[model samples]
Target: MYKIVEKEHFSENVVKLIVEAPMIAQSRRPGHFVIVRIGEGGERIPLTISAADTVKGTITLVVQAIGESTRKICALEIGDCFTDIVGPLGQATHIENVGTVVCCGGGVGVAPLLPIIKAMKEAGNRVVSILAARTSDLIILEKEVSEYSDEVIIMTDDGSKGQKGLVTAGVESVINREKVDLVVAIGPAVMMKFVSLTTKKYDIPTMVSLNTIMVDGTGMCGACRVTVDGKTKFVCIDGPEFDAHKVDFDEMIMRLRAYN
Candidate 1:
């Protein structure tokens, strides 16, 4: 069992939990994720590792309680333990010195992008991060993300904090002013689709993390299959990250909206 050592409410519906999993913490890379189950008969869910403290043997998970499984996980207290905590799974982000890179994150997507941005910074790239949410209250990890970013731009749809626009607007500002080496975006499917569309116009290399529906997470279920460059790719193994320009957004959108 993975023990929950600490928990904090980042927002009304978002919770951050630290789990005592030394092995996973030490093994986890910037973009790796884990499959967790709250208890017996519970559904397996995949979440990105927001941060890891190797020395402390803990991994941080920032989760938005959006559905049944997620809500149950969010309801867990500091002392609660998970029935299953499997991985440092999937491939890690490819970090390299890509000159000026922009890491665009929206809402809970900020949690996953945080570590990637830090890794990019350490790779000797000048990192500009754009974090956004519907309102100020929905934003998370503002202070932590700022530490790693060369410049951090925050956007809120309601304009309660930072600029009054979408994260794509921030990307536009950066793209217009400077030569962007790459753009990595993670957020709602619709938001990622738009971010990819926006970056495509500038011809900058762009990647996006897809949060498709999954069950086994081991690539055996084929539930999270997505089309990239016209070929079927399983998000679990092939990538949660893929070339944004080549991904079939229309197909992905149809699949994502089927039951919703």
Candidate 2:
């Protein structure tokens, strides 16, 4: 059992938990995720490792209570335990000195993007981050993300904070002012789709993390399958990160709605 060492509410529906997972924390890289099970017979769910502390033997998970399983996980208090937590799974983000990199994150997607921003900056790239949410209340990790980023832009649909516009606008604003070597976007599938489209116009290389349906965290389930560059790839093994331009977002978006 992995104990929840700390817990904080990011918003009304979003909760952050720091869990005791020494092995995973020591080895987890940016873009890796874990499959968590609450208890016996509980549903398995995939959650990205938002941050990890080797010395503390802990990994952080940011969860938005969107459904039954996530809600259950979020409802647990500090000192509670997760019955099963499996991974450091999925491919880690490829980091290098890629000149100027823009990391775009939407809602809880910002949680996973934080580590990548820190890694990029450490790799000697000028890192710019864009954080977007439906409203001011939904925006999270601003202070944390800003610490690692050279510049931070906030976008909200409601004008409660930052600019009153979509994340795509923020992407274009940066692209127009200077050259961007790469863009890493993680958010709703639809947001990534449009971000990919926007970057494609400028011929900028972009990467996106796919949060798809899954049963087993392993590829055997065939639940996280996605089409990339016209070929089938399983998110669990092949990638949770893919070249944004080549992914078939339309199909993936439709697949995400299958249960809804």
Output the number of the lDDT-best candidate: 2
lDDT, residue 240, candidate 1: 84
Tens digits of per-residue lDDT for model 1 on 1-260? 89999999998789999999999998899889998998789999999999999999999999898888899999999889999998988889999998999999999999999999999999999999999999999989989999999999999999999999999999999999999999999999889999999999989999999989888989999999999998999998888899999999889999989958
Clashing pairs in 1: none
Clashing pairs in 2: none
lDDT of 1: 0.93
68 in model 1: Cα distance from truth in Å? Answer: 1.5
Which segments of model 1 are wrong by more than 4 Å? none
Each model's backbone clash number: 0, 0
lDDT of 2 by residue, 1-260 (tens): 99999999999899999999999999999999999999799999999999999999999999999899999999999999999999989999999998999999999999999999999999999999999999999999999999999999999999999999999999999999999999999999999999999999999999999999988978998999999999999999998999999999999999999978
Off by over 4 Å in 2: none
> TM-scores of the models, in the given order?
0.98, 0.99
